[model samples]
Target: MPRRPFSPARNVKTREASQALPPLPLQDASAAIAQSKYFLPGEDLDGLRRRLARTLAAVEAQPQRWEEAFYHALHYAFPGGRIMANAGAESFKANVSTINCTVSRTLDDSMAGIMEAAREAALTLKAGCGIGYDFTTLRPQGAHVAGAGATTSGPLPFMDVFDAICRTVSSAGGRRGAQMGCLEISHPDIESFVTAKREAGRLRAFNLSVLVTDAFVQAVLDDTDWPLVFPAFRHEIGAVPTIWRRWPARDALHTVNERGETCCRVYRTLRARALWDLIMRSTYAYSDPGFILIDACNRMNPLWFSEDIRATNPCGEQPLPPHGACLLGSVNLAAFVRKPFTAQAHFDFEHYAKVVRVFARLLDNVCEISGLPLPEQRAEIARKRRHGMGYFGLGSSLTMLGHVYGDTPSLAFTTAVTQTLALENWRAALAIAREKGPAPALREDIELTPRHLAQNPALARDGHKAGERLPARLLHARYAPHLQAIATLDAALIDDLAQVGARYTHATSIAPTGTMAASVGNNASNGIEPSFAHSYVRNMIVPGEKAKRAVRMESYELLAYRALVDANVDAERLPRAFAAAGEIAPQAHIAVQAAAQAWIDSSISKTINVPSDIGFDAFKDLYLHAVAQGLKGCTTFRFNPEVHQGVLVREADLAATTYEFQLADGSRVQLPGDALVEYEGGRYSAANLYDALKEGFYGKL
Candidate 1:
């Protein structure tokens, strides 16, 4: 018999479900807040408020000028339209922030605090925020249960429940709930977890990733065996008492270890490389199940002394434990790319460095001011003092300088920009340290090592005499225990500086800036992605109101059907725009990602948008090509929208519930209310008053 698909409405819909799932109580909100203050000095309220006020004023005063400047700078930094937009009313509010949460055991437990969790998710989404979850603690497929007749389903089924919730909630109308889901490597269901999304239509509501541990990675590298374990639980299997085992414990006196309450009957251990190969294969085929370097995540964790980081947020940018929220802000690299005095001129590093410093300070301020959803999130954030400061518009930046994204010159420029950005971030971080004290993990002796002194003979001697030596100051300075204690400075940071010389702890990440970029009118490539196309049709939703009641209306019905049903209107006149990667050649797309990857210290989130004509073999080759180019990860989208049906609803259809409107007064408004409005003649109209309120309340200006 085929098993029925699980529904949240059944079994867990009533208040009984809430009662069944109890919240994991903690000390208090203050403990979490204090932890955030200790680790994340960046979350300083006074500093953040001051910076935000200044930034808001600057943007409001000359919105267009700043938008154009950001657009131009980002274009110059990444000519491929990778960094879509930088600063503007719309850009500032959207894609620049996030809300992260940690589920206890599973969504069932998280559901105990469901109202709070949903409230948090809704609030953040309403403010144009993205969300992430760590679902590692959920039990595997079949196990004994304390409730539910002493039988178990598992995390996957529970995740389906969460997906339904996301679909139904509809954050703030214009905001679609974007989420990340993660599971740990040690979980008994790790393989199933990694391959969950491989079936194409499964888990479409969220992005999936595996939290890879050092043990798991080392086993893969060393070609060794791996173990699978389950958490302890009380059960009686057919009148035989049983206990779920944690791990094999060694007995000191007997020189033997007993496997306590072994649940190995339902588990199997495999060669780590074999599992790794499976992961790579799935990634190659589906462009999903990307890896999180668990060791790397913990090694540089500022709060490692207190808590363990199990997973990252949906986009895989910020790693957090349970109930931890990370606030993110990105600098428009293109904004800093100035044209030289000559028509054919050189890149400007000096000015770029200064802007990066300012941007870093601004991002730090966001943490202090942003409202957190959970006490756990607030507490975890404070303990680590973590922030995601990234860049956008690399493709545009390259184009501004007359450089093609894939060429050697372009790659070199990317490398230079990445290194310079790192240097500037570190310098600023150091200054902040002087003022606020070093991030808990930062070492005392970290200092800037001049570039010329290390590479040039003349500069080396001159620098040494002037007490500004390069190699010793720059290279040796990096090895300092204090700096190393914070975050590992690796190839991503070293590559740019090796040619020159610069140093910084944490640098490089590409964020998904879709809505933000569009608001600024720069086009949407979402960070380091190549433009998906020159133009594509987008669907919008409008609200309608009659008296006090409201209804949701589809824009297509307003424009397309109105012409057919009422006065015939031509749909051809509707505006369309292209995404960089959407229409570009496959090789060019690869080159574009590579060029941007050259400068970024961390992994980039880019999907090579391929046409339907490309074969599986070609897809296979693209993966190899990306790996050869030193890319950490890559995703590809075939033009055949049908392929995405089971995995994701078309963005156009989803957009029907959300939309942006350019008001007659030159202000932008976002509509996400429950009321419906149809688009006619490219304008929104509602049947009555309720619809007006729905549209009016959620519209962004």
Candidate 2:
């Protein structure tokens, strides 16, 4: 097939229908083109896609065949927003990474070390990559700041510096910086960290998550008292406060700062359940801080022998070690579904697998092209060749297949689908290793010492195999039985892959998709999630563009239904088989994620949306349930106007309310929609205040 001509379509509307609704793809395009990412100078939509294809095509030894393969991949599913925006663009050779997420180098507790880490984070943010940090290394508030000759103000205060850096960088770039701030649950400042978002307009740039260890979970379940401890000081720095001891996340649980009897202090003891309640109550009120099973993250990490993961990306999907990067993309599942809403509504697993393979190769090329800002990041990525190749439109595909979002069949299907993806991705990675040679850091089998075998029995066999494959033994034991049970696709995929080695270490991760999902996804449900509402009025806040605009675009399932009707076939209607985000139960949401996570080597970026009426105890149990299922992490979103506001909201929800409560995302005006009473014995509304301000009635601060 010949390539399509580069033409930016304007289904946007003429002057006549200008007030009328625009198309979903157009909205997506508009958002993407807002920055020079997807569409560069003199480049139209088709041009952007072709350029992306051309760039990926250049990577092939035989360019023509792979070019066609890559172009086909784009037509079916979109690459991650970073790849779409950065890849094949004018900055194709620039020192900017196509990887979307990364973790900063560990911060030393000293003022100089902390500053240096912040500088590194700034350098990364400057290059447009979001970064995450583990703040638990810093001592508790009121604790000694070893060398600074000062009492500590806690990690929250230092976080302000990072928040500022993010704000400044975001303002400069016109696209705000993205960040993740994580603290261990055992940190003395855990209480303040959990409630940081409760303070309006605080840490506005960060996505907070509590790094929960298995011991913490056990303590919570047993209702036992837990200690909030920090390492004791080693010695003073110059004339500054004494610097305290620091422990790696892997060793933090076991190491005690026993430096003679003189250097002693009692750590605070708090009831585990009480602390758990605080996290639940705060999350219930504001969906700011999330929870990650840090122990689970480490235990499951294939690269655990080399690195320790302390923090995650802005989204919880990618948990990375210091200087780790997350390069990602997804296959569009909706495009591969055939004969919708019938017995023949089967997924094109063969085609999906091919696309996955193409993406695996494409991302390998990206590792070469990604001009990571820092040498450590570039070195880390070069060594590991880490990439994530998960898919989107899962909800749409399920709905189109005439399946419920969270039923047993759905769970089974979800598991099978992901299993196939992982298997295919694994196969592709191994093939790449065979053809293009393995990544530099692919572990060659080395003899393990006697002590090493005693410490980690799993590595008792000489050393890990050459190339970064998941090992034939692990595949046969862990994957084959489940995939064989699917009975849909051939079991040969796993059998064939188990025999080969891999190119990259980590392969699959489900991302939240952000604006790109709306842009290229035809507003498909994001990253293993159902649509937020059937068809809600989405208020798009385009930076520097006019605000308060509303667009009512149909959900992915709705579009699928419309396609079915257009094809002259009757399909199951909405609210019957199709369920949106708010409509689905929280547990159901969790089930879908847990099902999908079975094959995702990294993590799933999903939010279990809870209703305002949900009980506090039940909300707390949700995290425990997630642990029982061996999930990586869980985040929830609830409607609270007093807190930060959300971007997307349902149309019917507003009409069904009396007092309007805006979904808080930090940009909301601190005023009620209704003027129910007088303040200071005078009538007032937000409008009144605005009028007063306009008239210069109040004195300036």
lDDT for model 1:
0.46
Candidate 1 matches the true fold with a TM-score of 0.57
Q: Candidate 2, residue 579: CA error in Å?
A: 1.2
Best candidate per lDDT, number? 2
TM-score of 2: 0.82
**Model 2 Cα RMSD, Å?**
9.1
**After superposing candidate 2, which stretches have Cα over 4 Å from the reference?**
1-37, 42-44, 91-95, 234-246, 249-266, 444-456, 459-500, 546-550, 566-575, 656-701
Worst 10 residues of 2 by lDDT: 6-15
Q: List where candidate 1 sits over 4 angstroms from the true fold.
A: 1-52, 55-128, 147-149, 171-174, 184-202, 212-266, 269-307, 338-345, 440-508, 538-603, 617-633, 645-701
**Best by the TM-score measure:** 2
How displaced is residue 645 in candidate 1, in Å? 7.4
